[model samples]
Target: MSQFSLSNDNDDSGRLKIHLNSCYLHVKVTRPYIIITMGDQIYQTSISEYPDGRWNEGFEFSVSYHAQLFDTIQLDVYDSYMILPDRHVGRAEIRLIQLQDMPATFTSFYEVWDKKLSTGASSHAVRKTTMATNVGALQATISYRFLHIGDPQQQQQQLQQHDLDRQPMEDDLIFRKHLQQNRDTADILFHKYEEGSHANMDQLHLGTQGHTESRTTSSSSANTMLGSLGSWFGKGTASTSLGHPTDPTTDDLPTDILNDIDSSLKTYPLLDTLGSWTVSKETNQILRAIGKLLAAFGQGFELSNLQMLSGFAVVERFYQELPREQRTWDVVRDLSEIQVASHLWRYSMASYGWKGLNFIGKGNGYLSDAIRHHSDSKSVMEHLSLPPDDLLAYEFRNSGAFRPSYFVAHDPSTHSIVLSIRGTMVRPKLIAYCNRHSIGALYIVGHSLGAATASLLTIMLLDYMDELQKGQSLPFTLQCFGYAPACCVSLDLAEKYKDHIQSIVFADDVVSKLCYGTMMDLKQMIIAGAEAAQNLGISQFLWTGAAGKEKWKSAFEQVAECRQRCIDSMENPRLYVAGKVYQFWLDPTPKNPTRIVVERTSPKRVSSELILKTSIIMDHLPTNFDIAFRRATESMMTEPREQQDGVLDQEDESRTAEQELKHTSKRGGTDGSPMIDEQYTR
Candidate 1:
């Protein structure tokens, strides 16, 4: 019993047991066996009698408990033929840490890959082909455990102390060493530059001395040399001395010598003034023309503004002819602000993969149809609709790298100008066609990277509102909606623009949580979680059944404690969610898997503590956000406003928004949206 006890094994060494179950192969092989290698040790299994590659054999290997984390086990399957040399069929490598992080008894299928061929075949191509062809799979069970050779209680205490001491020591040593290396390199570079500059100056002085000697016969030449020397020593002396005869002038010096003297004097001042320099409008136009010509020569063609305008006209005419019902002013007024914003947010996401006028050539107003179809699929543009003709202008730009795309559309029914910026990906082009241009309330919408852009643009407009409306009779009113925007501004700026901007963050969305402080906290939390799992032996029970859930609960509690410590130690200024935030998440209770909830929370209330949930990333997707919005809207309609608002207000006052979310999904729910309710069951 003592020997079987994982925490009290007689020997300090760790043992790994592997069971060879079976292999499914594409090609038939006779009497197949497997060769297993781990670190310096190797073992071979006996050949199976069945031709289908079944062994049903078990083997054990001893490993140093401390060193086992870095070790990997390699399995090479071979066919033993009487006449031919044993042929290698396939191989698979399994890292020991992977098995250690799983249940005590884990069974899974691993892909088997053929040895690289000598005939210049790409390994990646071969792997892809093998996967595509359903080549082979090896099914096996792996078990691993390690116990310290000491009293259980004392060993646990020591292990905790060691972990606490070792991690920081290692990280600090590495970081300090890297920082020192950088400082040394920078010092070397600076010294080298300084020495080189001095040498160049000395050479210039020598050249001037020689030139002065050669031109000593003329008084004018001497005066010119004196003038050049004075310019180098004093500011603005050359310009002042040019008008006087007694004073030295620059006219007599050779062009090359005079230019060199002028450049040397200008270099330092240029460095100081570089930040203030701006290109004139004419220069920008010239550069734009040059860029256009270069692009035409490189791509063999260019998209002309005339062609874009024609495509826009066709799309506009097609939409105008369609028998679509226009929204009445009363209906538009009845829609909630968030509902309208969510509709515009769809436009933000649709901007990605949008080719603008390029799709018009497909015929029958393909571009307009595509946008309408996308909006219908996402269930957007329903309440206050904007027709294709209302699309005043659209621009997409990609200068060697992907830049965000934007479209300007007018909703005459609501009397609002919509600017939707798309997230990152692909190239962008521009098109514009407007029958009647009229100013209206400005609404800006964007998602992900585009969201950050929209937020900044809103701030700029707010700051320069006076300048923009200098001569205008009516003041401009603008609102911005950012969906899953990155942390783009300071807490001050976010608070300052709260009235005009709103950021919609989905449950456990990682993008919105990103900031210097949050990232640091996340890093610390990961390290702490890993160490806690190992110390508490929680990893061994992972995926085992009901007992695993109990272990995971304990593990999360420990990680939460560690995460709190990390938060207390953080000193960096955390960038909060911009403006008033509306967060959507699923009801955490098991009985309400499809019920989505919304909370209107402040930026400061959003948790900086990173939660390790699968939804952290998936929740950031636009599709997920769309589903969340739809469900949330439905939930809002069904539930009384007062009741729902009371529940949200109570939840906000009781605990953090994220903490409540994490507590509800403590049973390993992957996503916080109803779209993945099936995942909760499994």
Candidate 2:
């Protein structure tokens, strides 16, 4: 057998350079992922030895020539590295090389081979075979000789920026010019230092035995210049620099690209008139803006389902268009009557928590199995797939144009079942189900307007405590809950119901704090002093059970450390003000805040100890953060529906025992006072 073999030549010594074509790559191609490797395959050559006086050309040739060879890194894993194009791998070329074994890092592969054999310009594809394939036939070493060539096209795709490789604009030119100038200045100074003109330069050039530089006035001037240059470079754009090797002139900007972006911005007018529209009407405009964004960003095939977002937006805008005389951001109105929609669910659908479970074989879980399993939630909305417990939608469903005959009622929202969405209705039905079953212990976890409703319900129940206590009977039910209670409610309203509700605050979820009049600065109340960290009571307040103990402790320490940094930065206390709010529901107290935080209370109808949503306010706690959210939101039922008999639906099983709620105009009573007397019973 002819002794066939691969070779690795590494002899890097004393400022040595090497020349090689782009084909000299160790490319590992798999179907999905392609890895390129640069190795010690280059024979001894110098960058300065280019045929013409093009030293810079030699550098460009080295990088670009190498880059172009990997025009296709199609992935298909096989024995060694085969050059099979259709070999189960994706289309794309990759060049792989080692960091250290490129040149002068290994000995000669061929003992007597000539140094410069067949050395002209040649670059198409590199032949790569594994070490195992090298064997006795081809003696090859599996050294860390690999070059990592990134896929610019793929990277552009990942960024979702279509015009990444497009011609540069004036902005790009400015940014790159700023970058290169700074570097050029740095090199010039380094050259001066080597000449030993500055303070102690000779020592730095030599090391411990040498001097650094002389502190001359000129040196100070040079140093100041460099400092300013550095600042300028940093202020300039770096991430936006997608400059090509062949630098384009300032006039190279594409006219069409600018025109496209200009067209898009025209949609959202920066200066719009504030007119006599009601608050709901104003909200509708904002919802419409968001809908436009969804339509713009999510246009591809995979995200075609996001078109539902458009419908969602329209629905929300329609809801906001509701007259303020009817109900301003009222959850009860939406749930009790399908016609009063301000589809605040627009925000709720996009990112409100745990809504994707509605498609699991027609169940009331979370998301539809389609979405939970599919990448972008299923092609259909999981929530829309689910039937809500609310009965109010029944009337709307009976309407000519807005009927929901598509979804079946394997599960129905009957008034008899007091907790959760017992039925499968469309949007109105779902809301009615939630409202109907949510009479006493209605944990209303919602966002945006939905969150506002949750807040209102929380306030109503707390304000009507006597009514609620009697209706729930402790052995019976609890009232509704909110996620990020809406903006319209005042801080006074939030505080009044603060004792009865539980809130999970996102450190970054500024929605509630921004919307509501005030935020409970628990950062100060709980994380101000270092001494507040070590208190076991605080630990127990946030975490208990064997599993949560260590994490709770660690998170406490992290929070403590972060707080110290904030405290140290006294002048700019907001340095750590970026910490997000988790959730702090109304403290169920009279006993103690800790009792509510720890979820010490047992379920009224069940023997299980309830899980109260509390988190260790720490540096990075995403998993625990999510768990705490669910804990605070567990056992949440949907709104109830009106009974078919036309009497009206009851929220809790014991709801009838409580007083009847007044119409929206007089919900709080004849004086428009807000009360939850309806949820409570005598």
Candidate 3:
């Protein structure tokens, strides 16, 4: 008999007493018995009667304390068929940890599952057949207790044995510490090589040699320290190195590998752009450039400061034509339309300040103030000039980090529900929440990140409109106004939803042009420019500084050539700005004052080339959009009715004429136009 046998042995560490109460099964059996297993020990209960299957019998086992704490007990019920093999009815398992905390006896009904029935089925399918596959429920009582074996002397000896058991673990931890230190040192050296900060080839060679020597020294030192510990434990010496025993050096690299690297450098135009500097320098630059290219391919591209400044200078000339008076124009008087861009701007701004102010509480005291005082009311009410009692219900949901926060307000003035979504906050989770509360007209307004969310929500709502309007008498209408919104939908979707959405993009706002295809084009442009510079043996850095004007000019020419090629090669099925886009740009005609022009343009037309400008970030701000909207509205209001209607038709001719005149005049014009069409071919 094993030492764990239940024979009332005084030396037993502990005992597990289990009571077999009763079991219920779907299928009836003649003879049923349960096999209980804990660690290597197994116990079988006597065969119970059919129909009810109640034994009400108890069994006890002598188990060590470690086994009682750690092991899981499994109960398998089977039917005896005499000639045939025993049929597995069901099975159930319980860990000792579940009953360790119980004061006395722990009694519960454990559901037994038919393992054969559940095989090869998904979790969902298993859930659907849970009732069918549940062979029976076993109601059992479990009791576990520890027995005092000896006096304090024996307990003290056991404690010492526990310490002896932990000695190997402590030794392993020390080894790991030394190993980590070596790895850290190696990582630092590798990092230095990657950064190309090494002074010269001699230093690089010495550093590599020193690194190998240090790694070997550390490995020997660690082994020496652990040698005595290994002997005490009667074990072999532990492996010191985590990886390969010998580190491969540059001299060890195959000639074929070196040739492959050289070939790769030449074949890739971007790699060639870095030129043959030090091996380390070339490798570093190539890696950095490749990383940037891959990132752009994944997350969209960003233009260099030089490119932005160049684009801004070209676009700024248009803004300079705005009359001095109009440049300082502000919204002093209220607009006639309540749902105008200015109102939307105010609503969008108020959404940002929703959490801070107390006046705009759940009860809406400030809302009442707006209704009562009209213009005299201070706070957000002064900015939001809605009609009396027009504000109905409002809700601000900003719970999760990833979830987008939105301010929903009911405005009866225009029979619409206004949803003002806040722009990207710190660590924001991009999630869309769309549900129709009212059958009223829905107007979605957002700037930047929020604008993208609003656009997507509009599409989602449109797709599920039928289900949403199942019980409603009136159909819901969604109109989205996105200010400087990111490209969120494909060109096809944008065209499809043109009538329902409007994207108001400020001049040269970079966010508006950020899309997958445009970014890929940007990557292509960089590579092409690099190739051109490489061919001429000119450094690409010359374009950013005044080290050599002639060199910079040549480099810029190559970049321009690449830019034009990239622009011409743009393709389709790419993410485009959602909705009918209205681009507000400064139009400065020669010999005329600068005027703000709001033109209706296609998403494809706007995203053709990246408008690199210093004001790209600033242009996306709500305050800037507010000022631009006010000025554009003022410009439209002041213009003649006939001119207002014919603006779009005459825009092409005017633009063409301006381009031709700029080309014919000085290549470097006095008015600082820069002759973009002739020089850069934008």
Best by TM-score: 1
Quote each prediction's TM-score.
0.41, 0.22, 0.39
Query: Between 2 and 3, whose lDDT is larger?
Result: 3
- Residue-level lDDT tens digits of model 2 in 593-650: 1110111111110100111111112211222233233322321222133411122122
Instruction: Pull out the clashing pairs in model 3.
Output: 308-612, 321-593, 321-594, 322-594, 402-429
Candidate 3's displacement at residue 314, Å, is 13
Model 2 ranges off by over 4 Å? 1-284, 287-355, 358-442, 460-478, 484-491, 515-626, 629-682
RMSD, each candidate, Å?
26.3, 31.2, 30.8
Tens digits of per-residue lDDT, candidate 1, 1-682, equal: 0113233333222557778789888878879888876643567878887766677777676554333544456777899998989998877767564554476567888767654421111222223444554348788876665443454543554354455536757854654454345334412110000000101111111112221112233554444445434323322222232232210121223334344333322123453354225432223333443443332222211123443333233222222332211111111111275676666665666454223222212123433433222222112223224443454444332210122345555666456666777532111110011101234367778887678778887875564344333334566567889988887877777888999899987766778877646654454344334433443343443344677556556655555564456556554346777897877655432333355666666676554544444456777767666567676676667755454533322223323334444444555533343334532221
Any residue pairs clashing in model 1, and if so which? 396-428
lDDT of each: 0.50, 0.26, 0.50
